[model samples]
Target: MTKKNLLLTILATSVIAVFAIIALMPFFFLFISSFKAGSEMIRNGLQFKFDFQNYNLANYALIKTERDGIYLKWYLNSIIIMIIQVGAGLFFSSLVGYGLAKYKFRGRNIIFILVLMVMMVPVEILILPLYKEINSFKMIDTYAGVVLPFIVPATGIFFFRQFCSGLPTEIMESGRIDGCSEFGIFFKLMMPIMLPAYGAMTILLAMGSWNSMVWPMIVLRTSEMQTLPIGLQSLLTPYGNNYDLLLSGAVMSVIPIMIIFLLNQKTFIAGMSAGSVKG
Candidate 1:
């Protein structure tokens, strides 16, 4: 490569690295802030002395009517909602994607395009009408009301389809010749091969479900039903900021995701190969 091109590449890499750091700065600050006294965090600069007593779980007590926290309820609610939607999302999408990839059908292109078209539409456009429909069905403020609408995604189908398309047809044909039923072949053989794709899919679905806000906020009316994002929003006072409590809340919201990712790391990396390089 020419010196000019090399210089440009270096410059681009440097700029991207800088931007990545800038984006992550808030999270780094938030983690550290949770460990400091509220007064010291605001009044002093970034470097505050560590004090375990200062960082007591009392910050989380703001949400509790009792000992632990009402935040715990929100956390549980979020987990339940996430479990339902992501499970449904992955299951339905994978079924459809597998069919599309493996079978030849009339109007296949039409259906695929229709699914892709959904990606073009902004979610906000559907909100008002969706809310009205939910209300009409008397589903508002319920767990089903919050999770049902979000239980499917065009992208999940697309990802599964892409991954399945890359799979060799010889395997399927071999399974058929061996007198393997379609369900048996799919579940026993194909599913095992699709682990990497499922891993990536799980990560995407879980993170999105965990962080989902606007729709949940719209559907969940009562404090009892609020999820983590909604609960954190409620923590923001009408008065100025409560730094320690805010930091603690942020940590509570973030730590679970980190732990989940860490625990499932091998699978997550395997999943990252979903639509990419084959084994």
Candidate 2:
């Protein structure tokens, strides 16, 4: 390669590496801190220096014994919520997006415009009404209350719609010629072709659901039903802090999202970029 091109490549790589490290620094700190005692953390604060002598698996072990292993319950709850939200989100959001993109019907543009408008509104602003609505339906303190309200997120709909718009409709027509039902065409034919989009959305939806704290916090009343984030935050009280449990639990909470992203990293870039371009 030319020296100029090589130099540019090196510069870009160096910049990206720096940014990646910057992003990962917090996680690294959290991982290391998890091994420390609560007193040590409070005394020392977060430090760059790793004293191997102070590190131990005690904090992790405490997770199993603390409050009769309540941490595990929180983890399980988060997993359940994440799966439901991601699965239902993708299914319903993609179907709506697909219909909006592929079908020429009355008020289609208006509906798509409304989706865009919803995307602009912050969830915080709608929380009051959402809570009231969920409460009215007697879904409060239930998983349904948390998951149902956002099962088909506007962001997901917008993403899937944009991606579907870029796809060719020829395959859809061919499916009709072969006497395939509309759902069959979408599920059997178009779905496979949209694998990249699915992969990308899967990671995005998983992360959002996994990390969600506010809506779940409001909906879930019982301690056992509380999600990972809420459970982790409960460690910090005005009386004292349980950094031993909190730090370790925080580290564990990140695992699911990291796994999802790693599994879908290959298609994430392609899916995100492809959705922006029109066919």
Best-fitting candidate, scored by TM-score: 2
lDDT of 2: 0.87
For 1-279, candidate 2 gives per-residue lDDT tens digits of 699999999999999999999999999988988888776767777887988886889889978998899999999989988899999999988899999999999999999999999899888998989999999999998888999989888998999899899888888888899999999989988887777888989998999999888888888999899999999887876344477889889998888888889988887565444422244
Work out candidate 2's RMSD over C-alphas: 3.0
Model 1 over residues 1-279: C-alpha lDDT tens digits? 699999999999999999999999878877867665455666677763455555655555654533256677888898898888878988888887887888899988888998798867777888999899899989998989877776768888889999899887777887899999998888876887777778778778889889988888898998888998887777565444455566677777887777767766687465444432344
Minimum summed lDDT over a 10-residue window in model 1 is located at 270-279
Q: After best superposition, candidate 2 residue 149: deviation in angstroms?
A: 0.5
The number of clashing residue pairs in model 2 is 0
Count of clashes, each model: 1, 0
What TM-score, over all chains together, does every model reach?
A: 0.80, 0.91
* TM-score computed on alpha carbons, candidate 1: 0.80
Model 2: residue 190 alpha-carbon error in angstroms: 1.2
